[model samples]
Target: MACMQLLLLLCLLVSLCNCYRMFGRFSRIPPEPQSDSAVQDQWFEQKLDHFRGADTRVWKQRFYVNDSFTHSDGPVFLMIGGEGSANPAWMTHGTWITFAEKMGALCLLLEHRFYGKSHPTKDLSVDNLRYLSSRQALADLAHFQTVMTEKLGLGKRKWIVFGGSYPGCLAAWYRLKFPHLAHAAVASSAPVQAKLNFSEYLDVVQSSLARNDSDCPNKFKVASATLIQLLNFVENYEKITSDFRLCQPLEINTKMDRAFFLDTIAEYIMDVVQYNNDNREFEGVKTTNITIQVVCGIMANESWGSPYDRYVEVIRTILKATGEKCIEASYKKYVEEMRSSCWEGPAASGGRQWMYQTCTEFGYFQSSDSSSQPFSGFPLSYHVQQCTDIYGNEFNLAMITGAIQQTVENYGGLNIESSRIVFPNGLIDPWHALGINTSLGTDIVAIPMQDAAHCADMYPARPEEPFVLPAVRKLVYELLTKWLQL
Candidate 1:
């Protein structure tokens, strides 16, 4: 009896840990801690293998419900959870919940499997991870929808799906794969086509910065060239290590070292630009309410110096703004940690799960181009090599290329002929280049929100938000209304 009780307590603790991870994904502003009982609200339990045999292994799936505005025969607003743990915050906040309330519709936020508390297997080994595909996830949703509706006796209620970012891709794909489950979808920043080379990402970053200050892009370009040239010499490399305050000396001999070093800098720049909101804080950083203009202003204040000197000064300024201590950059640390074996590492399951998805289906590797771009160190080959390192020799360039082609063929890519799926992306979001930016069919529409960041329309209405974001939300509502009418 004692052993059984202890086991049950351990299970309960793991369940609580799942709830905590929901806050882990978005650490910009700390959310209030909820008790286990509070976390239990509206959560459901379902079998792990919705497609496979009757193994009867059950896991709890976290979700939030709002029936206050829902009529017995009203529409169902289903917001699909993304890569991380699903939080009730989305159900309570966000435009989707508000829109559901306006339409007197049932609002439900379903967490994805292998995320939140919905773990399928006891371990996340590569072999076990075979069940963690998007196809399997969608199947889980189909089962969940069927079971939930039957349990609630919600018959013939039209269901409209909603998602943002990677979940936005899931939302659109779910509608395409399972038309019987969802009437329509609202995909914000959804990258429909999967590709191995995504050089256009940096192009947008350059453009976003140029829009802030035309000189900014040129300055960045010059700095990049200087860094690339310095990597050629041992003494210059040592100087760079000292100047940048890197915790680990970059092994220039190793090809991955060079690629990882440059990729890290590019990622930092992308984050600041991607979350370019003056009202909100960037995730896990001291940087609060920043824009590209602010970054340029910091660079502009410095005296004109050698390319190498200018590069060091600009990086230091940017790092300080983003809450880094500047005592250590740790290029090797960043690369080794990221490229560490996901099978037996301290990295979270959510990250590993996403990496697996990228390895198998979406090879959206953002590499530097032949042009004078800031991240000139990274080539398309680096990303291809990363896939091989992560998943093994089987996932080579040929395999990845085949997967990308298969994805485009299977899902219709950006040219999908699906209807009633309103695709919206921000002009400022780098991911917009991969997303649908034009209408494919009469019912399908793509609205580009001006002066907006990633998934800008998905957030709750804020006073400081750009005018175009709220307008996009209104358009989404209008689209939803039209879809339901049919």
Candidate 2:
């Protein structure tokens, strides 16, 4: 659900911060598309339903291409966009573009159907969203590939795919499902295995923070314990709300609201740790790289007062950074925003669409079910309820489990047997838990990278980045070159 302007506007609209998973996967602030002569924006007439022969509905899917460094017979490098709108800059920049330049490959960035300006549906109604799934998206890629083959005179040209996060899953799955259509794939920080309750996400977060030589885990445990103890008392709600500087009175009438409150609070550290430090830039005045070290530093500062006081500061710090007016912890408001069937406004962040995907296809519900996690108030039940509230009563726990199971079965989960595919996973990224971690001979392989978080390798190589990235990225290039024969 988190893949955004790529993410800033989406985050501001969806969670008033980093847009959950995918947005962070792409960016926190959406960078404007820099005008480049080599980059050309284009649209393709994509099928609304790939399976239904009778369904003749079609929509214009947006995509971009960059031919700056491409030779006539160079390989094709397609960078698939996930939940976020495909940034045209992706055609001109990013690690994929770097590879394209090196390999004399043409770069293409394809926007997902429901995201960005690609309107497969006029609205976000449940009935209309039936067509939104990974299967259909993969089909979209196939259709695009066929079109590109004819349009660009790429009849015998080999195609290699690049994707991060949800798009990463697509890249790997695309190679698996359409082996004839693709030559290879590079999936970065991708969670291929479908899960109903992603408690490991939290576990990974805890491990990420603790492994960073930061006292954040201990500080969070004390802070969360104190807050949880206080929140249990109905009388302390008012003081807690006022102290936290919430936009509205804390909602505790139902258990869902309570869970939402914890979810909102936990997201502060969750997003920070998830993103960590990655070399992402936009034409903004500035952007704060909120890493785990920054958060751990905050938690360890005794000058901030008690652990609870430090926790409050963390929220304030994040709010100020993201330019949000106040802490929005109201569960009803979140539901109200998500329930809107309109295509514009806040829901346009692809939040509703991604939320629907979570409900129907990939159940990436980051739940606080494990007591091992500091953020423990929010349970898996809240995730189910959130889905039900946005969609309908039909999206219950049973339905969610079935949907997740179906996705896992469809893709063969982590056991996907595909050749010429590279899984570059960052140990720090929680999503890496679901991605493959071993090599299958010389073709299908996983490159486990330490200190890399989210899609760190997808970004252009930076001198200041973790030392392991350069080596891992080189290994990926060696594998890719061996396979692509470029």
Runs of candidate 2 exceeding 4 Å displacement: 1-40, 283-288
lDDT per residue, candidate 2, 1-486, as tens digits? Answer: 222232344344444432332232223335334566666668999999999999999999999878888898789998888886666666656777777778899888899988878889877789999989999999999999998899888889899999888999999999999999989999888889989888888888888988755578889889988898888898998988977778777768888888888777887788777767776663231224777887778888999999998988887777677666667777776776677666754655677888888889888778888766667887888888988888989999999899889998899998887789899998888888788888766787889989888788887777878889988878888888899774
Per-residue lDDT for 1-486 in model 1, tens only? Answer: 543454444343232222222121111222222334323446677677767676777777777777878997679988887676566656556788788778889988888877655666665656777777777777777878999999999999999999887888888988998898899999988888888788888888888888867888777777777788888888877777777766456567688877777766556566667767633321222554556777666556556475556657656766666545433233334333334333323233355566667778888777886473555888889878876776678979898888778888888888886778989988988889889998887778899989988888887677888888777888889989888888
What TM-score fits each model? 0.85, 0.92
lDDT of 1 at 351: 52
Clashes of each: 1, 6
- Candidate 1: misplaced stretches above 4 Å? 1-43, 47-58, 236-239, 278-288, 304-345, 370-372
Q: Can you give the lDDT of residue 112 in candidate 1? A: 84
